[model samples]
Target: MSYSRRKFIQQSSRGVAGIGLLGTSALGVSLGAGSGHTEIEPGAFNFGVASGDPRQDRVIIWSHFQPAGQHSTPVQWQVALDEGMMDVVAEGIFVTTEARGNTIKVDVSGLLPGTTYFYQFRVEQAFSEVGRTRTAPEGDIDLARFAVISCSSYAHGYFNVYRILSERDDLDGVLHLGDYIYEYGQDEYDERSLRNERTLTPTHELISLTDYRRRYALYRLDADLQAVHRQHPFITVWDDHEFANDAFQDGAENHNEGEGEWRDRKAAARQAYFEWMPIRENRAGGISRTLRYGDLLELIMLDTRIEGRVAQPGGVDRQSEAQDFNRTLMGFEQEAWLQQQLSGTTARWKVIGQQVMMAQRYYIKLPDLFGGGASLWLDSWDGYAATRDRLLGHIRDHGIDNVVVLTGDVHSSFAADLSDNPYDANNYDRNSGIGSLAVEFVTPSITSPGFPPVLAETGAATIMAASPHIKYAELRQHGFILLTLNRDEARADWFYVADVLKRSTQYRLACSFLTRDKENRLVSV
Candidate 1:
């Protein structure tokens, strides 16, 4: 992949200049009464623009501007086919208001597929840095490539992985499985030295729209994060931390009665997410939508948090009727939509953008003194066993081939084969194969404790020995995955950064996985 930073800058400057001057009334509206500062600081452009929800001929563009004051203003946005500004493709006017924290989103459409375009925003005559984005390929496309990223926590460490990813020009876009922002309070879980020690915006818990906005602003300020947004389009889905820890359909692990109601917190999180993210309004359902890359791939981005999820329990066995087969990660409507899309689509591969592990994990027998029981994360698919089984059943019943589940939120890496029937003890036997439903690749955290010696010393080893479906697992590393998809196969190279505690961009390929010819079987590469 090749990228030209200079080209990006030159095009962005031109787009900014073309927007012309901002009207005084608009300026007054944006800066509020008595604030004379109209020109924004150079650093104000630090949080770059991003594009997402790509289609064959359209894509959504996003950016947030912190004007001088608490007012509203109209911003001009332009999309061009070339970085040279020779052919202006799509241009529009959007209003940024205090209601939406000065954030602007535009859904630009009507262009050729599988093409690159440059975009920029002009607020009050001030131009933002240019960004490059691409649309998905049209029908009958031969290939598509994307980078899969997950678990980026600011306090844990630097986003050097994001920086390197931003420089890659070969990818069509990026798939972020979630945990884009952590909700930990200041000094709670700092991975590196507490240099920029600051509490999350709300200062308390984020249970309101204002709180969510503040949190997003803090995350957007990260240099590497901004760079990645500027460099390529991203298809994102939120995991637990975006709202509160272990968020379910109705409540969250971080929420309490006195703090606020779960509904209010969830609403605030969703609102802030929509306002700040480069996601398209759920045209079909909600955040979960399908993006097609010709007939080669269909990326089904799922909303596991906000939909029909059951309440998360403190322990694995705490059962409730809500956690039954009727309960769902995606509501009934979404489940039906997904099934319809999958059944009707002609795409060679079905890639699900999921938030947690889908593969089943069980305990290995051990002495009582050695902690015989397994530790099932109540927040993951393991908690929704029936739902997982149903989805796998659908894959098998429909003969859906080449289903790949891209997941995050465990703070660990895993490569596994999804089985139609997990209860089958002889799943590996060729005669009793149980039919492969899918293949899943789980990415580790950007900076979180993974399989630390303490965890290992406890009983993880025994659990690992019992779980055969999990072909490979790695804990205690922070990085991203580079995925390249060609006609015949899809390959992922796990890139690991040396250290997130210090500012270092060093990375190496830790491992690789490949699935070939719609087999849905992951082979070590």
Candidate 2:
């Protein structure tokens, strides 16, 4: 958690003055005649820097600055094509204020596409460490790859997976598909079963903006997470846990009648999320945006939480109505935008980056079971069957080749082929046939319970037998996925962390999946 003295100077305003190494004394540097030699101590501002929403020519840069005595101050940012700072490409000033938790976000633009740039920030007389970022490629690009990650819970285990992922130099970008931070208070969830679990810093549930910001700050303190953010540009989307558990359009399952108004809580969560995370404001138009990697790939990042979720149900039977095709995760406007993007895209692959799984999953009928049939978690695509079907239909109708759905929130790894009908048990063709659409790869949680005791005890055979579209499923384990995209095929490597209870970094390849040209089917890798 210690930053270098040189890094601090580079990020300070003094370094902006182009001062050479002065005589080293008690203070790091000696100021000239009228200049003060006082140095700003590191750790004054803790939240690390991040970049996101990468486009062909632009990407957003972000940092949260906390001045020693003042609430916050304006920090100047400079982006140079070279490490020597001889080729200054873009520069801007971002004011960090308490209103936004001293967070600053700058959307730097007008740079050459598919190029790497070095950037730094200056506050008063101190400058920050130089960070590197890359812009997306222009039209008809040759190659692209990204790491797909999600569901990193502090209370559940260590972040060794992040540490390993951070060291990988092959990724062009990182796609975080939600559940980046958990809302649970300390000791609320049991982690004794985990291997390398660590308790959260605050030891309390975050409900306010400051609490959430602090949580993010703590998370960024992890060396691995910081390295990963520093290593590649990130593209993110939020799932329910970012706001509250099982958050619908109007309210959440965790919100109560007396726990303030739902709108206020939702707004607070959204405000905190924007303040801490690297995302554009949730404007009225939509949170869906397209990132084109030249002609190679088009990543469509969607907002599935706020737009069209229905109110919480009164009972189990009432939940059945939640599946009304009209009850959407993405409102009509966003859905239309997605459909249009899919239809109009000329990229080799159309990647849907969002929360929740798209595959149709159902419970198997077991004779003399304790509770008969299993309940489908109403929060997933299972509860929005009609909308899921519609999306698949759109992909099929548009003949979108290499359409892949990257999802999270289930806290389990799932590889499936998107089919028109996955529930027709007697339809052998439906079971074995690869649908007209593409594939889906679900990354497991950084640390979340999966498969539970009962399901794990059953050996996952029943679940696999029930859902044929689900080609693969692993109820246990925690890790991230590395996706390599080529002109002819897309490959996903499931990196499973050995333990989440302690701080170990051991991992193994749980599985791999690949999709090739002409054949939208996903073959086991």
Candidate 3:
């Protein structure tokens, strides 16, 4: 029942039109008399191929075709085990039209668990890029690995992060912790006014569905992003940028009456998000769902920006009303669902793939004698202190062990421990009835603003000096986190590119951390 990678490739090449024929150099084309590269027709899949929301024995395959002006057309898709695309395991035909943007999304099922499958779409004589995707493993499993990334602004230099990530063949998939595409338009932010040719599109902030669609169009045009999508599935969640900066359920900081109503804008952004990304619809509360990876890891993907988040609490509210403990970021329904899942789950590691930092960060500006302490950010969980305290209290009360929070939206890498005493980060010594309840790993931005000047302009030493819980902080890096989880331990390796300005650059592993099972601690590797 077990198949080695060698055996899989061997079986795949047994016949012509094999997996290798799908267009990659390694799998050169063996189809008839055409060149190894057969350019697709204009009215075909010009944006490449992708798959996501992979479950055991099931996965979602997505492709977009331009009918030019046609109303409806039939597109065919197939799953093959061989490089030649011969040995067809499953095949189907789907209908597409301008109404759905000539896009096709198919949920293919009846496949084997923990199995790799290659798929492609045929629009008449042309073929969409062959996509490689694997289903999630079921029951007990030995190991799983994935790349965690976030905050990719088209105007902020190149997505060399995608290029580097696509080179990886061992990863199970990708976990995007939001900011997949920013809402800011051309020349919106002074920091985003880079010299990159791939500037934000529409020349304006996305407030309409059409605007959001065109924005996604420009982002998908990047060959690096396309290559990554064709290579592996992406499990994603949205952050504030998808809608607007500092977004809550009611409104956003960027939206104004002059632009449009906040509710309509939020709806447009949400619709575009689900339409462009290869994501499945959640039961309720939108985009908040849990994924079980065998028995080793359970990824609890949380939607912290929208759904039912309250407006951020300001300093006045914090001092005047005690910050209102009832104000929530995850809402009530989602919190209850998460509690139920974590309290009873059997997975060895429960990971929250969420947007924004959850760990407590303090501000310690020298008095006005130096320069007034800079304003602190309240958009993160720090703004909802009481809600965070409630969640941590629940974990401690229930004895939830091996909990790990993977965060984004800050554009920096951090390894921190969540203390049992939420009030004291430095006093988590396990003697004063205070100890670490969980650990968190924050992945840096892919191509967002490089902090104030460059990643973590304040320096890691300065940041850690304020928030002592963080064991390591790489503030000046634009990269992603590579995570490997097994039965006994989980390791996170940070990889950063040499330069985002260049189309191609040298990317190297910056550092690694090891978290022993149930230890709730990070050790530099």
Candidate 4:
């Protein structure tokens, strides 16, 4: 058979098999980490184990195996109630092959709601590290907490933020907004010091299946990234950097003719992402889905960058004309699906976990020599104002309450109130937040560089002075946001790591903001 034909068959087979592989049997519900398991050999399961997309009764567990042998190998997996794996509630045998990059992703089901479980993989006499994961709670959950993070570029700096988050015991899961990986070459986007300190394997831009796979493998080698994946289940969505810089549907700003066909590169990136991440295999084959935490929250993850976005026009100065072209950020189908989710969910909080910022972000006006008035960051929602209006308008028209948007991609933290017109004094009161429809919390990057201190401070002050709806902005930080939800309100606490150039656990809370159950605004805590 041809290579393409063989690849399709392999992918199809793996997809069908992995979609809903339940545990073979339930041994018991007790707890302990049995000492009887064989000692692990070096470099057996090199990538480690991870679990994600937690429902009330099911979650996806993942591992990659690369042992010297034949193309196919039989692996045994088990889930227990204790860290020791002595309980053995779920056990199964999954056959992995080189065809699927030697990666194993099993959607384990029949789990208890709102409970913690330990899991591990075994290949012959060797055992992988045991991972900890939790399922979402069932009816009437009073509280939920998740670590929101994004933009981890390997060449930028150390992943100390991931390590810090891994050490925390208060999280229910993780929300990775986007840019989980970058596609730039080692020297393309980093400084000389950074390139020498943390070198990429390929040393060139990723454009093929082999290239993308090797890049992911290199990142998985990080102890901090592996530690977080071992401890918490992550719900993830992709942004531009996952494929290439400023990626749209048909092509990317970073992709060129010399890099092969855009569709081929895109397919390569998508395949490798599925193979590595612990997210559940979508039968429909798209990265947009909704996860519910009983009546507390409904997390609607979106594919804003590539699902169906029309390529942005040439310059940022043409924003006024682009608005007339009727562009879409999340496309039509995704927009309809999101509308349905927002209108139907009875949960107290309707959390939209997406890539770019949704609130209006217009820069300060320049001098006449530089074409005068405020120019928008065309990549964000400011470029697709109509879609933002439609979505926020739907919430207002249908009387939907408690809508919170979690975003990343600007490498800065922000708290803003979503409004129909923040600039119009009649529509919204900056101090009172009268006409606000929803709220947004943007998380800083894990390691990607943000603006310098002076520029960040001045830019933030200018934006806030003109746009009162923006409550907070901290641009020169590399950390994650701890988002806590409850019956009364939703609070987001921003924490900044002490240093990203070196691996350190030192971090401090920069600030915090919260919105009451019925109010669609942010209040400083």
Query: Once superposed on the true structure, which residue ranges of model 2 sit more than 4 Å away at CA?
Result: 1-43, 84-86, 190-197, 312-314, 364-375, 425-432, 452-454, 457-459
Write the candidate numbers in order of decreasing TM-score: 4, 3, 2, 1
RMSD of each: 6.4, 8.1, 7.6, 9.7
* Per-structure clash totals for the candidates: 0, 25, 9, 1
Screening candidate 4 with a backbone cut-off below 3 angstroms (N, C-alpha, C), the clashing residue pairs are 33-84
Rank by lDDT, highest first: 4, 3, 1, 2
Worst ten in a row by lDDT for model 2: 18-27
Q: Which residue pairs collide in model 1, if any?
A: none
So what's the TM-score on candidate 3? 0.87
- Measured by TM-score, the strongest candidate is 4
Instruction: Show the colliding residue pairs in model 3.
Output: 17-84, 17-85, 18-83, 18-84, 19-82, 19-83, 19-84, 20-27, 20-83
Q: Looking at model 1, how many pairs of residues clash?
A: 0
Candidate 2 lDDT (Cα, whole model)?
0.70
Off by over 4 Å in 1: 1-46, 189-203, 283-285, 313-323, 364-375, 430-434, 453-463
TM-score for every candidate vs. truth?
0.86, 0.86, 0.87, 0.89
lDDT of 1 by residue, 1-525 (tens): 222232222323322211111212212222211222123343134356888888888989998665665566677777887765446777778988877767889999886788899888776546677778888888687777788888876656677778888778888898998888877665665434344333333334566676676667666756677778888899999887888888888887778778777887787788788888998886442678888888888899988776887675444344433145666766777777878887888888888888988876655323335432233564677666567767877878888888888988887778877884443565553332335667888887776556665664444454446665666677667788777777898777788888876667788998998888767777788
Error of 1 at 237 (Å): 0.8
Candidate 2 backbone overlaps, count: 25
Alpha-carbon runs more than 4 Å astray in model 4 = 1-43, 190-196, 315-317, 364-374
Candidate 2: C-alpha RMSD after superposition: 8.1
